[model samples]
Target: MAMEGYRGFLALLVSALLVGFLSVIFTLIWVLHYREGLGWDGTALEFNWHPVLVVTGFVFILGIAIIVYRLPWTWKCSKLLMKSIHAGLNTVAAILAIISLVAVFDFHNAKKIPNMYSLHSWVGLTAVILYILQLLLGFFVFLLPWAPLSLRALLMPIHVYSGLFIFGTVIATVLMGLTEKLIFALPSYSSLPPEGVFTNTLGLLILVFGALIFWIVTRPQWKRPKEPNSVLLQPNGGAPEGVESSMAMNFGNVDKSDSELNNEAAARKRNITLDEAGQRSTM
Candidate 1:
């Protein structure tokens, strides 16, 4: 578990660093674009929100990645931890989704989008705030010992909602980024790895990589032991064997055969006689 947490932490930290580094490069590119104004008028690149959103998105991604991947405890003892991690990731993801969606709209009206750059800036700032909150919550979870397993279950709804939102937002952001004039102002497309490097299309790369990472980390734990004892039923108490098996058997109220009833009666009678005989001998 420690190893897993470390790996997750590293992944998030590295990804965040990359995003920060890239933000600088992109900002420089935008500045140069503003000065050149090849196709555009010499507008002072008034507060475009793209940079902010990009940085925000990166922060969100990093926070969610860390929360989802880190943490040593499982559903057994540290349910609260699991829930907190899940909630933290989902919360970051939710903010990211909202910003991404808004980015889509902003990019659509790139020319008329009031304070487009500012929008990006605010989104980044919000992302930073949300990430900090998530980190705080994560620390709380880490220190906790026992927690209800249901806590993790409780976060599923939010997680699902946040995840769906991300899908839509990513798609929208990619599309708008690709088609808008803002992209044209940036450095030559060839300079980047591909034409759609900064477009919504790049989300596909993120999706694919995210999926791969999840698979790698959660692929499989050690093969489960074949024996029942090895199952190691959690502390959460469940039904007894008789009740569980009885429900499974689904035995309707059917009458027993006369012979079977007679045999059972005979067995009881024989046990009584044996007890009586033993008692008499002892006397």
Candidate 2:
């Protein structure tokens, strides 16, 4: 039953990821074929890079980064490797997102258009800033060797919640930006032009993608399996192994002699027998 549930969840996750990838591809096609192609020469077409990169990075890549830990295929790998992958993906996403912002700003400056004057701009900038901060905090606390274990434990929940909040903010900002672009670029947006309809559909797909990513990340059952003897190693060294490593980590690890373990097992068996006997008597 558990395997069936996991398979079902995996199917849903893959479907959502595919929808997001397609939506991003369609958005890029719409921009290049219908609106403007991408460039970096400070032309109006240069601005096209902003939306494309933002969608790819903030929406698509970030979604994958958020759910990387939840992927069942990574269960066999060490947690350290998974963490490295997660951080690496997020770093790439952040770099792409920053370049997208730079593209927008460069375009605006070249056109002599005022920047940060729109609600979309405000929300998007805020989201990016918060995302960068989240990344820095996560790196220093979780990845670096400076922080203690207690601090890492304390900050983990906050980091998770803020990450999800930033994801939602990015999606909301993208939706707003899409609406603003349609209103400005399409004269008949109020009358629902074809481009407007297509853009709205794309926006809906992005929203659904974000929702699915959030759902997968938050579901407790979908979390990655922690190894019983997993050890959080420092950057230098000092990692134990086997049962000793488990005890050192203190992740529900208890130190028990063989006799103690045997006694506990016998007690559990006796309790099960007593419970069965009581049930049979009641029947």
Candidate 3:
């Protein structure tokens, strides 16, 4: 695959970070300023925690998790370490999302409001549940030592696809939630009050951030470069089976000629035979 230069990738990455930052910051401003601050008191203030955590933890951090593999600074790190970082971020996102759900449920029950009655609620809950499953499967399939390389390879595509799908689902669910909240809270949402406009801007920022992440991840040239493992295997004269699978990402990089391995094996056998014969004769 033709690897693209870092200049373009860096530019897009910077833009993504900026947009994600703005989205989270805007969410905080909306809740703290316009919505009269946050709390855990089974009030609307507590419900405010939902949007704040979702944007900061779930949306922004999750976006970071998805594109982490493409980060140039992390290139020198072991693939296992990189995978850990990716999974760690996702786990944090899931935790925050669960907390946000608790906040919403508590506030609703306190206010005697019905729950799970809207499409936004349904989709959001479903997405979060699937996200959790994805995290667990990813840990077992990619991080665990027992899983064979072939299994990892087979599941990698599904893992990646599900992760992206969950991300997109959450984005859609968030947009729906925003619109729903505005319709009820603003009542005159058609007139576009300051709160409505500000919240809408937050939604737009989220869209931009999501787009940048997907673009970065889907670009073939932006994939993390494979390390050259053949150099390390040269001393052995032949590479171990599944050495390529161990690095996994560089399935094509580890290699040695069959003839070289055969020659080395024969020479080593002859040396052992000669040493044994000389020892016996001396005795």
Candidate 4:
């Protein structure tokens, strides 16, 4: 009913879920269409690419994107350390995305599905390394105490956008790689055979992990405390009660000596004491 803390984390998580959901749906359609394989010869599937590689690369990119959603609230306290890590990771991810985009144009072949496998490989590897560093920094930020709030606000969007662009680039390049085979097939850089258990398992894990992170970030927090008012009814907003009546008492002793207030007698005594003090002073 009521909103709680960490709304941003929740929103990011929701976005990640959507990305992963769309990814699964897209992969399913492509795989079913190309049940045999993504070959040089065109088939029922319009794209001249392997559904498997596209699926793998898409999942990989999605993994980074989804993980970015989880990084923000990972440590709210140590903002400085967190910001530094976040900034570094964003820079790296952006570089990798741009490089991957470049490799897209370097497709070796046009007809047999371009296998700019080297570019994809290098970019993917670097992205994964940076993603891991980002994860470590997210955890590190939680432990720090002096980090600034403003820095966190600025860095979060950069991290998220870079991830989104990276995912987009991966999809585009994978399509190019699928449309035509590499111009010169390098034995070392070929894709693994489709239906490999390891690959499928990894994809499933990414899907599951992304879903979990999204669910966490988007989920609503507990109800916040209501503000207080000055009304004397119950401080807790409960009904007021009547006050008891008792006489206010003066606690002074009525029988005290009046001599203490006898100003004339006190003045005479002061004069006598002064006379005696004058004699003493002179002596």
Best by lDDT: 3
Per-residue CA lDDT of model 2 for 1-283, tens digit only, reads 1333687688879888898898789789879877868788988788888889899999999999999887777788877788789889899989999999999999999999999999999999999999999999988888777897656766888899999999999999999999998888889899987888889999999998988998888788887765876544432334433545556657444444656798999999999999999999999
What is the alpha-carbon lDDT for the whole of candidate 3?
0.88
Which stretches of model 1 miss by more than 4 angstroms? 1-48, 58-77, 96-110, 113-183, 187-214, 222-283
| Candidate 2 Cα errors over 4 Å, as ranges | 1-4, 231-283
Listed per model in order, the count of residue pairs whose N, CA or C atoms clash below 3 Å is 9, 0, 0, 16
Q: For model 2, what is the alpha-carbon lDDT of residue 199?
A: 90
lDDT of 1 by residue, 165-206 (tens): 443344334334434544555457456534335433344444
> Which stretch of 10 consecutive residues in model 4 shows the poorest summed lDDT?
242-251
Q: Evaluate residue 187 in candidate 2 and report its C-alpha lDDT on the 0 to 100 scale.
A: 90
**What are the Cα lDDT values of the candidates?**
0.45, 0.85, 0.88, 0.45
TM-score ranking from best to worst?
Answer: 3, 2, 1, 4
What's the true lDDT of residue 10 in model 2? Answer: 81
Candidate 3 clash pair list: none
Worst 10 residues of 2 by lDDT: 232-241
Q: What is the lDDT, from 0 to 100, of the residue 87 in candidate 1?
A: 56
Give all TM-scores, in the order shown: 0.40, 0.80, 0.81, 0.30
lDDT of 4 by residue, 37-120 (tens): 333333423232333433433443445434542454443434345445545554454454444334333333333554435664
Q: Between 1 and 2, whose TM-score is larger?
A: 2
